[model samples]
Target: MPAEGARAGAATRGTQPAEGGPERPTRRFPRITRDTARPEGGGRAASGAAPAPARQWPLLVVLGTVALGLLLTSLDQFRPGTLLIGVALLAGAGLRWLLPGVGMLAVRSRFTDISTYGVLGLAIVLLAMMAQPNPWLQIPFLKDLLHVTLSNK
Candidate 1:
């Protein structure tokens, strides 16, 4: 048994034969290379170059124009004014879709899709509430009781 244990230890010591003729070369840290010297250019190599900052002025101007126009149209408060507001909203949405990544506007756009769904949800809720003669507005006591029961469960 001791001899077998010795043989087993010796067998494990040497490199085991790979399946193929030679083992595939691999680096422990794959991203590192022998060339540690920094390339020419003051710390701003090709790979490390920062992306250009997006121009936001144009987008801001467009948005401001749209808002001003919408405001002017909406001041009337008649049926036509309401229709114009709807049209303005639709045009804004279309512009958003057509020109993504225009200026810093893209940041605000992240919520656009979610806001559309949210608006739809709110409209549905409003319609449902309107359909019901009495909309339930929970009192503070009722809300607290509900919270307590839910927490206990």
Candidate 2:
């Protein structure tokens, strides 16, 4: 059998200090030394030297639309406001897909950002279209499904 020291020495060949050298922390998923590169389509909408807001116009447009939607909702115009909010998110998805320089609007990888924005936008729009007393759209099985799941019996 190998000695305990032999086992440890073999196990830590690359990681161990060279007989009293400085201790090096372990690296995990750290091939790059400084930082990761930005995702595709993640550059500024405008060139540098522009104001920060102008550089990130895509994100701002979506945010401004949503803010307006919220303002309408606060004034008791719920359905149209919600529709506008959903449309803003949908527009964000479109911008992420179509624009090469979306700046901060590109949250993650292209596919992930597109998928997330599309799904959330569609969900919001659908829910808004189906909200309460006299919903604009309906799924016939959803009522039965909800009843079945919620019933104690």
Candidate 3:
């Protein structure tokens, strides 16, 4: 067995200061010498990061439009007109989903938005019209003209 002092010497031998020379400096994180060691894009290391989620706007819009159409169709009175409006609304929404570049008009322009709303409003008006009985022609000019032309032949 070695003496205590000899054991201490053995432990410090490799780490000792050279005769007539200064001791070397030890590093805490040898892998990261400078801040420049980081890449231009700084964040978590490459080893274990989670991936980003994908966008699904098209799916969302289609589902929403279908729901709206279904609700409109279920309402009492004006079922056919409601169905027509639903069809138009769904067609427009479908176009917007399928063709985003063209849909930009729907998103960005007030005119297009108003026009779409106007079409919906017109559908409602047509529904009202459907509820009322058809009005007979007051003048009956066209029918008379047709009768005269047929009798002359």
Candidate 4:
């Protein structure tokens, strides 16, 4: 009985077989752990007991500005609303770059966060500038490209 238990334990732990036909493969995955380490720079934004909102103020501010932008759009203020939303994303990128600890705002590595924010913000702002009904900016090639792509004739 003791020998049987020893053999089973050895097989479970290592590649040693209990009653080997051919050495069985070991577990492919390791045991799961309870918690993961917090992402770097994801520390509490405001130290001490300042409540959750205050701690993640950067995230809240960005989100609030976005919400306001959305409200403006719903109220038939399209161009300004989109412009505001884009500006908010740009601000989020700046905050992520400048601040060391930004609580939940630091969802990914610093570079990734900044790159995502900057690209999306720039795209939105550009699109807003190019929106219809007397666009502020124009790209003549885009019209040609779309016509080439979409035109049946």
Give each model's whole-structure lDDT. Answer: 0.44, 0.88, 0.47, 0.89
Q: 3 or 4: which has the higher TM-score?
A: 4
Best candidate (score: lDDT)? 4
The predicted structure with the larger lDDT, 1 or 3, is 3
RMSD of each: 14.9, 5.5, 24.2, 4.4
lDDT (Cα, 0-100) at 14 in candidate 4 = 56
Please write out the lDDT profile of model 4 over residues 1-153, one tens digit for every residue: 999888887787655766745566776554776687776779988986898799999999899999999999999999999999999999999999999888888888888999999999999999999999999999999989999999898
Show the lowest summed lDDT stretch of 10 residues, model 2: 23-32
How far in Å is the alpha carbon of 111 misplaced in model 3?
A: 1.7
Q: By lDDT, is 2 or 4 better?
A: 4
| lDDT (10s digit) by residue, model 1, range 30-121 | 34468654322212111224344324543454466546656765685333333444444444444445554444333343356335634553
* Ranking according to TM-score, highest score first: 4, 2, 1, 3
Candidate 3's residue-wise lDDT over 9-79, tens digit each?
63445454544555554433454446543222222212233332113333344446556655665764345
Q: Stretches of candidate 4 above 4 Å error?
A: 1-31
List candidate 1 segments past 4 Å from native.
1-54, 73-77, 108-111, 114-153
Better of 1 and 2 by TM-score: 2
TM-score for each model:
0.29, 0.78, 0.24, 0.79
Scored by TM-score, the top model is 4
- Global lDDT for candidate 3? 0.47
